[model samples]
Target: MPFALYLLGLAVFAMGTSEFMLSGLIPDIASDLRVSVPAAGALTSAFAAGMIVGAPLTAALSMRWPRRRALLAFLVSFLLLHVLGAVTTSFEVLLATRFAGAVANAGFLAVAVATAAAMAPPEAKGRATSILLGGVTLACVAGVPAGAVLGTMWGWRSAFWAVALLSVPAVVAVLRSVPATPAPTGGGGGARREARALRDPRLLMLLVLAALVNGATFCTFTYLAPLATSVGGIAPGWVPGLLVLFGLGSFAGVTAAGRLADTRPRPLLAAGGVALVAGWAVLGAAAGSPVAVAVLVLTQGALSFAVGSTLVSQVLYAATQAPTLAGSFATAAFNVGAAAGPWLGGITIGAGLGYRSPVWVSASLVAAALAVAATAHVTGRGPTSPDASRLQQTLP
Candidate 1:
C-alpha cells in the first residue's frame, strides 16, 4: 500500500471522529444554546442529510479537478466549517455549520474512495478500501471517547475546536502525500455521465445491499447503550467500555475484510451475514444477561463492520464504469443506511418495543441484505474476482 493511502486514512480519522463524537456532546450543546435536547440532536440528522447530498454534489462539481486538488478543497472547507461552528453562539448558525461541515466531510470521503481505488492495484482494492476504512474504526476506539472527554472537561466548543485542529494535520498530509495527477478527461460532463452506472442492475443491486447491510449495523449500534443498561443490567458507567469493545471488534473485522474481500467477497458476505443474523438473534434472546450482551456486542460489531466494508468494496468494484462517481455512490449508500437505521430503531423504541427491539430490527435488515446477496450470488451478479466483475467489464 502507498503512504498516500495511510494519509487518506489519517484524514478520515479526523472526520470520522467529528462525525461520531457529536453524540456525546449533544447535552452540552443543548444546554449552552438553550435548546431542547431533541432539537440539539437534530444536528446529527443535519450532518447525515448533508452527507447524502454532498457526496454526489461534490463529486459532480469536482469531476474535472485533479483528485489532489479536490481533496484539499474539501479538507480545507471542513476545517473552516469546524472553526465557524466552534465560535458561533447562535444555535441556528451552529446547525448550519454542522451541515456544511458534513458536506465537506462527505466530499472528501467520496474523493478518498476513488483516490484509494485508483492508487491500488486491481487485486488489492479491498485491502485499500479496508485501510481507508480502518481510520473509522480507529476513531470509534479512540477519537470519539477522547472528544467526549474533551467536551466534558472543557466545553462542547472545545470539541469543535479539536476537530478543526485535527483537520490541520489532514490538510498537511494530503498536500504532502496525495499525487497531483492531471484532471480526469472523461466523466467530466457532470453527474449525467456518472449516472450511467446506475443504469446497470448489478451496480444498483450492490448499492441497495450496501444500504441494507449498513442499516442493520446502525440499528443495533444506535441503541446499544440503552440495551446494555436497561436489559443487560450493566452499570451506566460501563457503557463507554462497551463502546470501546465494539470499536475493537470493528477494527478486527475491517482487518479481516482487507485480507479476504478482494478474492472471496461472496463467501465473506455470506458467512458474515449469517453470523450477524445469528448473533443479533442471540443477543436479543439473551438481552438480560450482562455477560452475553457484552460478548455479543463485540462479535456483532466485528461481523457488522466486516460485512459492511466488504459491501463497500463490492459497490466500488461494481461501479467501475463510473470511476469518478463510484465513491459518491458508495458514500450515498452508506449514509442512507446510517440515516434509515436510526430512524427505524427510534420508531421501534417509540412503539413500546423496548430497547431490545432494535436487535430484532437489525436482524430483519441483515436478513433482507442476506437475501439480496444470495440472489446476486446465484444469478452471477455479485463480486467474483479482482480484475473482473461478474456483472460487467472494467473501464478501459
Candidate 2:
C-alpha cells in the first residue's frame, strides 16, 4: 500500500537473494576455498542458525532504538558483511560473514514487518505483509537464477558482490522513505514484556501453525532439483524453469492472501491446507510423470506460500500485546520451520526413501497444520477470532 513498504520489499529482495543463492554457488566456493562441498554447504546452515537466534535477540536489543535508525543500522551492517564475505579468502572468514550477514538480515526483516504493519491501516496489515514478502518470491524467481548464472560465468564471489551492490540502493531508499518512528514505549522492560506475550495460548498456537506450514514448504522445495531430474525424468536444464514456475505461483498465492487473509484467515487456511495435502499426495503418486509433476509443483507452491504468508500476518496480530516483538516471534517461527524442513527431508532421503518420501513428509505436515486450523476455528480459540478479545481478558 505505502511506497515505503515497497522499498522494504526491495531491501528484502537483496537479502533474500543472498539467503538462497548460496545453494548455486556452493561448488564454486568449495573448490576456490579448498573445502569439501559439504563444508561449503554449511554456509547455508550458518545463515539459518543466524536467522533463528538473531531475530528475537536483535529485536529485543533494538527495541528501544528509533525504528528507522535500527533499520538503517541493520542495512549498513548487511552491506558491509556482504562486502567482507566477497573479499574473504579463507573459508572460515566467509562462513563467519555469512552468519553475521544473516543476523543483520534477520533484524532488518523483523523491524521491516513491524514497520510495514505500523504504516498501514489495521485492516490492511495482511496486504502490507504480502507486499513485503513479495520481495522474497521475486528473489526466488529472478535473483537466485541470476546469481547462479553469474557464478557459472564469473565466480561465486561475484554473487556476493552483486548482493552488496544491490543493497546500496535499498539502503539509500530506506533512509529516504521509511518514517523515523520513536522507540517503542516499554524501554528497558521490552524483552520481559514480550516474553509474557508468548504465554498466550492463541499466540503460541499461531506460531506453531506458522512453523508447520513453512516446514512443509521447505521440505518439498529443498529437494525439488533431484525430484525433477530423478523422479519426474526432466532434464537438468529444465529445472530452473520449473523453479521459476513455482516462484510465479508463490507470488500469485501471496497476492491472493493479501486480499483475503484479514477477513477470511481461517477459511483461507483450511482451503489451502486441504489443497496442499491433496496436491502433495498427487505429486507423490505422479512423480514419474513430468507434466503432472510440473503442474503439481506450480499448484503446490501457490498453496504453500498462500498459507505460509497468511500465518505470518496472523502471528503478528496474535502478538498484539508485544507490538515491537511481534515481528521477532514471526521471524523465529518461520526460520525454525525453514531450518527443520530441509533437515527432515534430508533424513528421509538418506534413509533410502525415494525422493517421493519428502512429498509425503510435506503432506503429513500440511495435514497437521490443517488439524490445528480446524481445531482453532471450531473452538473459536484463534487469536483473531471474535471471542479472542474476551479470552485475552481472562488471561493473567
Using lDDT as the measure, which candidate wins?
Answer: 1
Candidate 2: global Cα-lDDT? 0.88
User: RMSD in Å for candidate 1, one decimal?
Assistant: 2.9
Provide the lowest-lDDT 10-residue window in model 1: 387-396
Evaluated against the true structure, the overall lDDT of model 1 is 0.89
> What tens digits encode model 2's per-residue C-alpha lDDT throughout 198-313?
99888888998989888888899889999999999999889888888888888899989988777777778878889999999999899999999889888988898898888888
Candidate lDDT values, in order: 0.89, 0.88
Candidate 1 segments whose C-alpha is farther than 4 A from its true place: 187-190, 386-396
Task: Give candidate 2 regions above 4 Å deviation.
Answer: 383-396
Per-model TM-score on C-alpha atoms: 0.96, 0.96
Candidate 2 pairs with clashing backbones: none
- lDDT digits (tens) for residues 222-263 of candidate 1: 888899999999998888788888888999999999988887
Candidate 2 minimal-lDDT segment of 10 residues: 383-392
